[model samples]
Target: MNAIQALTYANIAIWLGIGAYCFFLAKKQSEMDRRLNSLILQSKTENDA
Candidate 1:
């Protein structure tokens, strides 16, 4: 392949990697938020009792 084709491929790979990283990070943050919310509710229940 030519230089331009190679460059385009490199750019595509970089963007793909970035997208995967962002998606994983977003999933992790959502999981953490859910866990935190559950913990808060549990604490509140304990306090009520």
Candidate 2:
């Protein structure tokens, strides 16, 4: 393969790895948000009682 093609392939691979990391980070953030919301709702219910 040519040098330019190899360089492009490398760039694509790097982007793929970065995209995967971003996806997992977003998922983790979503989970944390859900847990936080649940905790807040629980507290509100407990306080109301």
| TM per prediction | 0.84, 0.87
Task: Write one digit per residue (lDDT tens) for candidate 2, span 1-49.
Answer: 8999999999999999999999999999999999999999999999999
TM-score of 2: 0.87
**Residue range 1-49, candidate 1, lDDT tens digits:** 9999999999999999999999999999999999999999999999999
Off by over 4 Å in 1: none
For model 1, which pairs clash?
none
Cα deviation in Å at residue 43, candidate 1? Answer: 0.4
Per-residue lDDT value at 18 in model 1: 100
Instruction: Give the Cα lDDT of each candidate.
Output: 1.00, 0.99
